[model samples]
Structure formats: structure tokens, C-alpha cells
Target chain A: MPTHNRIDATKVGDVTVVTFTDKKILDEAGIQELGAELFSLIERDNRRSIVLNFDNVDFLSSAALGKLITLDRKVKQAQGRLKMCRIKPEILEVFQVTKLNKVFDIRDEQDEAIAAF
Target chain B: MTEQSDADVWRRVIDLPSERGSNREVTDDLLTQLKVFGWPPSDVFAVHLAVEEAIVNAIVHGNKLDPAKRVHVECEVSADRVLVSITDEGPGFDPARVPDCTAEERLEAPGGRGVMLMKSFMTRIEYNAKGNSVVLEKRRT
Candidate 1:
């Protein structure tokens, strides 16, 4: 229920759908804020299923990817599911190059991610 | 980067404190020059990622965010290509020793992906013998 500067969170049935507000998630301060908000969904609110909608993000650095890796572990430790959707092809290349696409549950659309959970 | 030193193109050299957010101004300036020179968005994105990751490595891993230390960045932009070099004032490590972050066992780790990402995105990436400095280059084709 807190006001988040980096993302928008809403509930879809049992899944909490989060949308990134920034086009570029590069700066360290912004990445830290993003990681904190994401961790809070499971650590503070105990939301079990989460979908990160990336339609708005045009660019994201490795640091942002690092935060996602940590967030994925946090979600898994809490017995929750995490999925990411709507990644731009160029941005998706980053995941593929890093082989993180294999690690994350990435779908082509938002509804697919929501339904998967 | 020296190849374009005498050519007519957008160029800049900056020295900044080793800390968070210091790369933004230089990065923004480079992005603008690339845009004006007609580098497509996708190509621009690649340069952006490569540059951001390299500078951050210089500031965080190389300089350790030491206020006494400084990170130097040199950039050049042209219609044909863009080149960037980042150097940090700290005892350097070997780039060859950075573990492959994409390895199966290390996939879950949060860090160590920057170097690999830089290589994948940039056309060519080279580290100094001391590893305290890196040069990232991309040629538009």
C-alpha cells in the first residue's frame, strides 16, 4: 500500500502485478530503490505470486539485472513465483546474452504471465 | 579511440569522483551526440549499456568508490562509429580472471555480469594490461 516511486503494483487475483515506471533503470540509486520495492512485496506484504511488467522500460543496465537476480532468489526463498513479461527485443538480448532468460520465467505478454501464476 | 582524435567529431574527456551517479552526465552527452550523428536507438542502447557497465566497474570495482580516487572517461562519436575509454586510479585486477557469470552454477549470482554484458553488446572491448582501464568500441554497419 505504500507509494512506490519506481514501480506500480496491483493485485490480479492472487498475483501481484508490478509495472516499471522508469524507461531506464541504470543509476545505482534508482536500482537500489527498485530492488528494495520489489523485495518488500514478498518480505513485507507477503505477496506470493509476482509478475514484473517491463513494457515501459527501454533500457536497463547490469546493475538492474543484478537486482532482479536477488529479487528472484528472495521470491523463491519465500515460496513465491516470479515472472517477467513484455521485454523489448534489445533489452531481451541482455538477458539472452547473460543467459538469464533461462533462469527467469519470461513470457511474451502480460496476461500469459498472470495466467502462468 | 585515438583513431578519431584528429577527426571532426563530437568528443569529450571527463574526470569524476568515484561514486554513484557520476556517469550520468557523460553518458547523457554521449547518447545525445550519437543520436545527432544518426546512430539508431538499438545501437545507441548497446553503447549505453557497454559504457554504463564499464564506467561503473571503474568507479565501483576499480576505484572502490574512494573519494580520493577518480574515474576518467573519454568519448568520441561519429556517423561511422563511437568509441569510449574508461580508466580508474586503483590497483587493477585481471579481466581474464573474472568468472563467467553465465556458467550454470553462477547464474543465480547477482554480480559479475557487467564484464560479459559489455563484451556482448559492444563491437570490441579491450582492457588495459593492469585492468584498471577499459576501451569500448562500436562501429555502425
Candidate 2:
């Protein structure tokens, strides 16, 4: 996949770890870019395990959450697993409030997330 | 107009075209102004996210992304309070009709979570009678 400014992708064992470069992923443009990039990444990569690292991101809008949902769906369609790790408390609150916590496999650490895959 | 007391709140009202990019511009402007007014980083993030959700709702859901339509944004900032109102030009929907995204059946749904986040972060949230306009407020402790 082509390089993306909003996120960085790296490989750890069988997992493709995607990390957001921005601390705030609330902007519409950035959110759109992230969704497109992640979609492209999932399509191109044949890997079945994906770990989304939220360590750098501090706050994200509902739009960003929507993008994550989209990514989760794409991963599921690819017959792969998706896990989110290192989410801040405030950001986690959003996931909890939306009840996405139940739908997603979220972990307090990256190792745990990657291991789950 | 008469001179106002320092205690009086200052307000800025902006007219925005129903464009996606305007969300970033408005969010940056409001965060910058709030930071200068001595709001902490966390509070700034709360207001920023709340406003982004409101604006996106207005432009995308409310205005249906019609360039011909417009969104009116009003921001009132006082020493200890921040009030923002966003109005869109589309036909309104019933707020109660919005499904509960937190429910198990709706968890994976792609939409309908914006209002939940807005209500979670802001101190108070109110929708106008027409349901096309939403007001969000945060009062500093």
C-alpha cells in the first residue's frame, strides 16, 4: 500500500500494526484520509490479523469512531481479526458510551492486542 | 450599542457553507480562541470534539451535504462558560427517533453515535424545536 501521512503501518509477527500519527484525529479531512488509507491497507495486505494502536492519539471525534467501525467491518469481511490497544481514558469513554467496547476487542497494551490476534 | 462590562460574555457568529472542510476551520478557530482565554487542554479537546460532531451532523446529516445549503454557527465564550449553537438548513428529524447506539443490537451500526458523544462531553446539550439546530455548552469549574 502507498504511504499515508495520517497513519503509520508496521508489521509485528502476523499482525499489521496501524498507528495514527496525529494526537487529534477529529478533523474531517484527516478522518476521511484514515478511513481510505485503512481500507486500502486491508485490501492490499493479505494478513488476517490487524492491530490498531491508539497510543499517539489523545482525542478522536465521533467521525473517527465511525472510521474505526468501518475498518472493523472491513477486517471482518476479510475474515481477519481487529484489535485496538493503548487507548486513552477519554477516548475509551467514547467507545464505552457507544457500546463499541462490546463489539471490539480492545486491550490495555499493544502486546495483549497483538497476542489476541 | 453600548459599552459592555468585562464580565459580559463575548460572542462570535459565523455562517458556514455546507462543506466538510469547514468543520476543521471552525474547530481550529474555536480551539485557538478558547486556549487564549485560558481553557485547559482537556476542556479544549472536549469542546473541539463536541463542536466537530455538531458541525458534521449539521453539514452531512442535517444539510445532506448540499452546497447550496448553509450552516449557522454561534459561539459564546465567557470567563467560565462556553456555549455553541449549530443550525442547518435541512428538514429536521425527531431526536427521540434516533436509535440508542449503546444497545447491543446497534453497537456495530455505522451511524447514530454522534449525539451520544456530544452529550457525553458537553455539560449540557439541547436541540431546537425543529431538530435542525443543536446547542452544546461547557461550564468551567
Candidate 3:
């Protein structure tokens, strides 16, 4: 298992449950590193059924959302599933305002997200 | 928008290189002021998000990360409101032409959502005709 500075990825019955290492995902350089770390789960590790737990992330910029969008695309191309759980209400509003809630598989809890897979 | 009252004072005005992280100082000041003035966390989040997006757009999209250019940032924060204006030295593009990121076909696209998020979070946003400058405002709620 590769060590990731930007995220903590653990396995829950073959599903990679990932949580961020940053409270605020705003900086461009940091966001790029985060995106790369996430993409690696699918591109390099070839893991399927991923759930991104956003319990600790209190804030994120639109650029971070872009990376998640690209990651979702990559996971789909790899025939893996990507789900997001535990997004803060304020951060969740960002998703709703952008109408990305419809595009993403968002669940209320990590167990729910994992069960959906 | 042209006239400023006694209360409308710009707290910080900076000319920064068009580098990726150059907006940090101004944004840091704005966020700190908001919190120190007792703005709620949710409101702080909105203001912070809008300001970050506008400055990043100025550096990345408008100035194209040209170090030769600069991003002029003017920010004002008071008890009731926060205002920030950012202008880039690039050949300005048309904000109207930016495709709707929410449109069905473009929903999956990664780019082009910054402007929308800025508009959504800021209480009001105004762009100069040349589109190189943007003013983001948020009122205490």
C-alpha cells in the first residue's frame, strides 16, 4: 500500500475508503497533489469501489471539485465505482448549488456508501 | 459601484505576480477579518470560497499564470459586508461566453465551474466589460 500525504486510504472489503488529510482544500498546488493521489487509486492501484469520506474537510474550492469530477470520470473508465460520504452541510451546499449532487453518488454515511457499492 | 461611502474602505490593495499561490495573503487577511469580526462559520465559508475562486481565476484563467503579469487585488471587510475586486493584466475574455457548467452535457466537465461557484457564493458579483476584473461582495446574513 502506497503512503499518501493528501489522503488516507483504507480497505473495507475491497472498497477503498478514503479521507482527506487537509481541512481546507483551497490551494492550487495542494489541490493538484490531492487530485493526483486520488487518481492513483484507480490508475495505479486499480482498486474498485471507492468511497471518499469528507467528514474532516470543512472547506473546499471549486478547483477541488474539478479534480473530483475528473476522478469520477477516471474511475468510471476503469470500471470502478466512486461514492462520496460525510460531506459537511456547507460543503454539500457547494455541490447542490453546482448541481453536482445529481452527478455524484453521495451518501449520508460511510457505512451507507459502502453498502451501496 | 463607482462611488464609495465613508464606510466603504478597502482594507488591502495588492499587486501580486500571476503565480498559483499569490492570492494567499489577501485571502488570509479577508478570512481572518471575517472571523475576528464574528462572522459565522457558514458565512465565512461563503466569503472565503468566493474570494478564493475570483483570485484564482485572475491568476490562472485571466493571466494564464504569466509571471510577467500581475493580479491587482482590492479587498474591503467591515462588520456588515466583505468586498473584493481582482483584476488581471491579460487580454480579458468574455464572461458571458463561459458555458453553463450545470448544463446537461457539460455537467461532468472539470473546468469552467469556478466562475459559477463564485457567482453562487457571493451575494453579488460584477465584472468589468473587458472581463479582466471581478468584484465579489457578501452581506452578513
- Which candidate should be chosen as best, given TM-score against the real structure? 1
Most lDDT-accurate candidate? 1
Docking class of 2: medium
Considering summed lDDT, which 10 consecutive residues are worst modelled in model 2 chain B?
B1-10
* Cα-based lDDT at residue B50, candidate 3: 85
lDDT of 1 by residue, B1-141 (tens): 222334458888889899898888888989988888889988999999999888888899889999999998889888988989999998999988999998999998999988998899899999889889899999985
| lDDT (tens digit, per residue) of candidate 3 on A1-117 | 899999999999989999999999988789999999999999899998999999999999988999999999999888889999999999999999889999899999999999998
Backbone clashes, each candidate:
0, 0, 0
What ranges in model 1 sit over 4 Å off? Answer: B1-8
For model 3, how does the per-residue alpha-carbon lDDT over B1-141 read when each residue is reduced to its tens digit? 222325444377789899888777767877888886778988999988888888888898889998899999887877888888899998888888999999999998888888888888889999999989999989999
Which parts of model 2 are misplaced by more than 4 Å?
B1-8
Tens digits of per-residue lDDT for model 1, A50-82:
999999999999889989999999999999999
TM-score of 3: 0.94
Give the lDDT of residue B108 in candidate 1. Answer: 88
On TM-score, who's better, 1 or 2? 1
TM-score of each: 0.95, 0.89, 0.94
Docking class of 1: high
In model 2, the Cα lDDT at residue B23 comes to 62
Name the candidate, 2 or 3, with the larger lDDT value.
Answer: 3
